[model samples]
Target: MSTVLIVFLLYLIGMVVAGIVTARLASKSLDDFILGGKKMLTPVIALSEKGTDMSAWLLIGLPGQAFKMGIGAIWAGIGVWVGSLFNWLVIATPLRRLTGKYNALTIPDYFESRFGDSSHLLRITASILIVFFFTLYVSAQVVGAGKILAATFDINQVVGMVIGLSIILFYTMMGGFIAETWTDFFQGLIMVTALILMCIVGVISIGGLGNVFSRISAVDPKAALLSAGESGTALYLGLILGGLAIGFGYAGQPHILMRYMALRSEKEVKKAMIIAMTWTTFAVAGAIFLGFLAIPFLRGEIADPEHITLAFAAKILPGWLVGLVLAAATAAMMSTVDSQLLVTTSAITEDIYRKLINPDATQKLLVRLARIFTVVVAIIAFFLGLRAERLVYWLVLYAWGGLAASFGPPLILSLLWKGTTKYGVFAGMVVGAITIVVWYNVPILKNFLYELIPGFFLSLIATWLVSLFTAAEQRRTK
Candidate 1:
């Protein structure tokens, strides 16, 4: 094979071996496997958490989106930064305290206990959604890895995906969460380093910032401006708001929040939050700069956008450096995939299988089942990855929208609103979940309706209306 592919294969093999070794060390029990025994150190937690949240979106999707949208794409990163900060500040401590108090191990478990343990149907529904949507989400990460392999080594997409998925799956299934988190920590560092190097090389290649921006402006003035050529104030604000809504997905995401729950103590969270946000800011800034700098070097060929990082690296960097950059791309996808696999497994084993199917299941048995679930989910994701035909960003966003709409409101209401009844939470979830699916399928709404707007609002309204009606009916019966 080509030298680039060999380099990538070597790096990937090392990661897989490391993951397997760590998984053997870490996966003694269900708790250790699923939640890292709730004892991840601050640095480990921070890196793994942030790295898992980023995925290929940071390395590929964001830069690509920025290339396509121009400076307007900066708003998307900013929204994520602000939203993450808010999540750490507003939800971290409370979630830790409450999850510990309730002895809840997963997001769905927390919901079931906090809302009322009368029946676990809600938790089951939530778990099903997590598995369903996350399989699609994980598929996107696999597709990203395939793209990197295809571009870097000239491997076919299908072969690349299989190789990529196998590496991630082997480590995750063997090592579980503990193995995954430590891997994420090292991968996070590599990702940051690669991006920084790319940014530096990219800027120098294009005659510096002034020349780059000037060329971009001359070619696509709309892209250079934040307004994307819109002159109206309302239009600009809407665009910004649209970008900001991305953050709203943070609070409801099981994978990231699971990291918060895994903190050794509630005390570590404040420092962890700072570290995570800072890392996010730095990585996102570097990505945007890379996209901007690429404008001059790539010219018309940058139309694909996602190819900007790889294209620039191929042109500007040497064979070895290019290998390192490709490894970073793999790292980005693996970081996110590991966390997602853990959360998906947790949703199945802890939330549904044990709680509903067998409340008295042993920890050993649960751990075994979790491993099985991890493998099964990975296989499903791989199959779906084979079918994906769109940009990684669009595929991920659709799944993200479904997840945010379905769980975001309920998670928020549970924390802030005491009047929220079990029925109300269920109503909100149904409305939110159905709204996302319907809006996605209905040609009219699918075209014009952003999932967040309708799904979020309808969920909120459903919660309020149902809670009121239930409460009033109870009062009358009394």
Candidate 2:
């Protein structure tokens, strides 16, 4: 096994150093801390958004799915890429303009301002949902870190978890939004480059694309076919639907949405959309290839399929090169957790504490409180990581479904439909959240489909119906 630990150590140090370097940038005001005062450049926002969205799931979870499910796993890659494209094309510019007009710093704040909800109901409900789902999402990232460390270094899972968790909290506390964004941009590059490099090397080692397919086909006849890897047409249909399920979530993610909001100008988002989509093209293809390539080499031997990326890297790459790949995978996890922590903190500090509790709160005080809440949230997530109830993939999907279902319908509809009422959006969020929780826990329902599919559509229906009912009443009142 490749035992070069120094590369991983250096990567962790680099994350903390980024935070220290950006500390001065975060100290000026709440806007600066939360969104870089809307001054981030195009490349920075583009790659950072990609990095935040990819997470360790790109390297760990997706590959694991492809490793186990064969060629049919492409559904997930397609889902994310198409979903992301939709979010950029449809939601980015208008959202930037709306948030700018409202002077809003967080999603909840945007909700209140956009809908003229002076009752604070929209703001509080949105904030509560953000906190609830983001904390779970961050916990999944923490869990990914532990899994990586344990697999790479042969360390106890708890120790590995703590090491990864502590660095993320420290760096995030040190620099806030700008720091994490900058870190994510760099980490994003490392993740893509490493994943692609591994794919190229694996393809070459396997002799050629033809050989790879034949070998995997030798094991399972349908494994090489993109449309179906299992026996029944029914099984193929299930794979496609379940894989595409989470695509609906891209429009709803607060951490990813924040990147769009922080762009220097709305016009720049077009250029950024191209850059980000190009990055996604490379990253997703690499992940999918990695998983497929590993099926011939590591199938049935590995205990945890999610460890396939690192295990395969150790098998093929040199000692130091493997270390670099390990760092890249680790970077994927850190890039995500830091952003989720900051987004969750903003929900607590900016949306709730300042907007609701004390309108007169100073920028410095709110920033301090944000840092404080960042710690509290990280601590809560750390314990959840220790529990390790599910694999990193499922945990992320559940949280993604909740956030997407609850927030996606409301956010997307309000931006597009003038008739969307505050009460309607609130009701949609509640229904969406409830559907995910219920759908995820029941085995029959969970097996029927990916929870996000039902949750999202149901939420959309609730939003449209409730808005139709309430809009006329609101007009009567006015």
Candidate 3:
């Protein structure tokens, strides 16, 4: 291998070692292993949570979209940003309070307690969706890592996938939540550094932001402006709503909300929120800028928008610097993969195996089972990702939509609306899930309608309508 490739491999090895060490320290207790024992401070929780959440899609896919569509893609970030801000401000504090009050360890656990614990099936089904969809989503990240490795070192894509998976799986399986969070903290910092550097280098290489803008205008004037104004009201609203609606997915995601439940206290939530939002804003904004910055430098040679960062860096920077920049993107991908593996394992070990199949299983036994399940899920996801066609952005968006539409309405109502019934929650989940699947598949709907707009609203309406029509005793008996 070349010197640059060798250096990149060494850095990755160090990260893997760090992850294993963390897992060894934190895996003694189930809570500590999966949720960090609810003792995480503000910065660790914030950076780790948001960093894991955004992943490679932010660094690769979003920028690629921006490079292709110009300023129109900024709305994607805007929509997600607005939604996340609302989640931090309106949802995180209450979620932490209630999860703690009920001693809930997962989103499904929160649902079960908040809705009076009448039916465990709700939790089980939700857990199934999380594991099922999240595995597919995690696989996409795996695919991204493979692409990164392949592009970085001229390695085979499959070989890269195997290498990336082995490294990520080592830390994720061994360390659990502790492993994921600490690694995520480090990876998040790397991501920020790389993006900032990419932005700076890209701008300078292209003669600054003004020259960058001027070139884009010279290429496509409409694409250079904010709003793009290309698609018109329906499409714009759909994209914005689709983007912002991503925030709702957090309430349903076991991995992300695991951060909230693990936080030291409610007071920490406030501090974490500020930190998370700031990181998200800068990281995403910088990535979007990097995409635009690549336009002038790359001309038309940056054929695959997704490869803009890698191509641009390789062309402008030295080999060592290029390796570092690629490492940052790898950090983003691994940070997300670790979190997904932990949560996916949690669904099986905590929710399925321990709760349903073997309630009497010892923690030691459950830990073993969790590790087994982690490998099993990762293997399945790796295959699915290889067979899949879409890039990181599309796969991530689909998974995000599914989780949000399925759990968002039920979660919000169970917390705020006293009359939310089990029937209502179930109805919402079923309808929401069906709508998303069907809408996406149907050509007419996919062509004309945003799947989330219909699925989300209809799910909310179904949840309410079902609650109204159900027997009075069916409601949250508070």
Candidate 4:
């Protein structure tokens, strides 16, 4: 075997060991499995959240966007950064306090408790949405893993996806949240280091920043523009707004929000926020610059722009470093896929099965069922990854929008507005999720703006309007 392959194997073995070690901490109950018993420190929680949040999008999708659209794609990065910062500032502490206060284990459980939904409608609805969108979201990450593996080993994409899925499932099934979060912390460092190294090396390889821009401008003037210059003022405004709108979805994403719920204490939120934002800013900047630098190196020879990072590693870096970089990229995907897998498993076992099927089930039984569900979800996502035809960025964004819209509005209202009722929560989720689906299918609407923008605002409006009437009804009934 090549030296690169050997290094990659070593990294995989390290992750497996991490899983086995953490598995001991996850034996107490479902809470332990899903949230690491809520004892995670600041750094582990922060890095794990960032690691899960960035996924393959940071390494492949975002960079590809920058390469294809030039500096204009910076809007997406800025939006996500701003959104994540605010999510930390506004949602993190309260969520940590509230989840602990209510003894909630999952997002659905939080909703059910927050809204006083004894009927279990909110829990059931939220659980279903989690499973639906998360399956697609996890599939996107799986597809990215397939691409990376295919690029690395010259294997078929389907085979690559299966291999990737097996690794993620094994660790996640073995250790649950403890394993996933700790692995994510390690993976986060690898991801940021790889991105920064790729950026620095690529810039040096292509002469300098000045030469890089000059070459790109010569190849395609439109690709070098920072804004929608010739695309008209309306288009420019739309692009900026749509890009910024990406941040709005951050409030609603279950996978990311779960980190807040898992924190050991509300005091840790401030420290964790600083670490997460700093990491995000640098990591995103590196990914974007790496994309720009790839232009001069590949000279437009590549068929898929998303594979630029992996291709650059294989071609430009030394043998051992190539393996390290490849492992980092794979780390990005695994960190995310494992978290989503755990969340999806929790939604089924914790929310649906426990709440509806058997309220008296033992902690041991629930933990076992969670493991089984993890395998089942991974298999379904594996198939979805094989059949996925869209680019990674769009696929991720599509699922991201759905989760943000469906869960975001209600979540925000529940925390801030005492008047928020179960009816309002239900209305917001349904409207938001439906809006994303309908808006995405309509070519003209999607062309003008991203589906998340409309869905988020409309869902907020629907929730607010419905709350007025529902709150009054709740009062009168009382």
Q: Per-prediction count of colliding residue pairs?
A: 1, 0, 2, 0
Q: Candidate 3 — which pairs collide?
A: 23-175, 38-262
Off by over 4 Å in 3: 1-3, 229-248, 386-397, 475-478
lDDT of each: 0.81, 0.88, 0.79, 0.87
Tell me how far the alpha carbon of residue 129 in candidate 4 is from the true structure, in angstroms, after superposition: 0.4
Candidate 4 residue-wise lDDT, 8-42, digit = tens: 88989988898788777887899999999998888
User: Order of all candidates by TM-score, from best down to worst?
Assistant: 2, 4, 3, 1
The best candidate by lDDT is 2
Tens digit per residue, CA lDDT, model 1, 1-478: 3566677778778777877677665557777888888878898898888898888888888888887778888888888898788889988888888888887888889888886655676797888889887877888888878877876677698898888888888888888887788889888888888889998877777677667778788778787888766778887887787788788778778898888889988899999988898888889888887777777677697668888888888889988778888888888998888888888988888887888789888877887898899999888888777655464345566787778878878777778777776678788888888888788768887655467778887888897778777766534533
Model 2 TM-score (2 dp) = 0.96
> Which ten residues in a row are the worst by lDDT in model 2?
388-397
Residue 101 Cα positional deviation in candidate 2, in Å, after optimal superposition = 0.7
TM-score for each of the candidates = 0.93, 0.96, 0.94, 0.96
Residue 7 of model 1 has an lDDT of 73
Q: Positional deviation of 6 in candidate 1, in angstroms?
A: 5.3
Judge candidate 2 against the unseen true structure and give its global Cα lDDT, from 0 to 1: 0.88
Our model 3 lands, by Cα RMSD against the true structure, at 2.4
Model 3 residue-pair collision total = 2
Clashing residue pairs for model 4: none
lDDT of 3: 0.79
How much is 68 displaced in model 3, in angstroms? 0.6
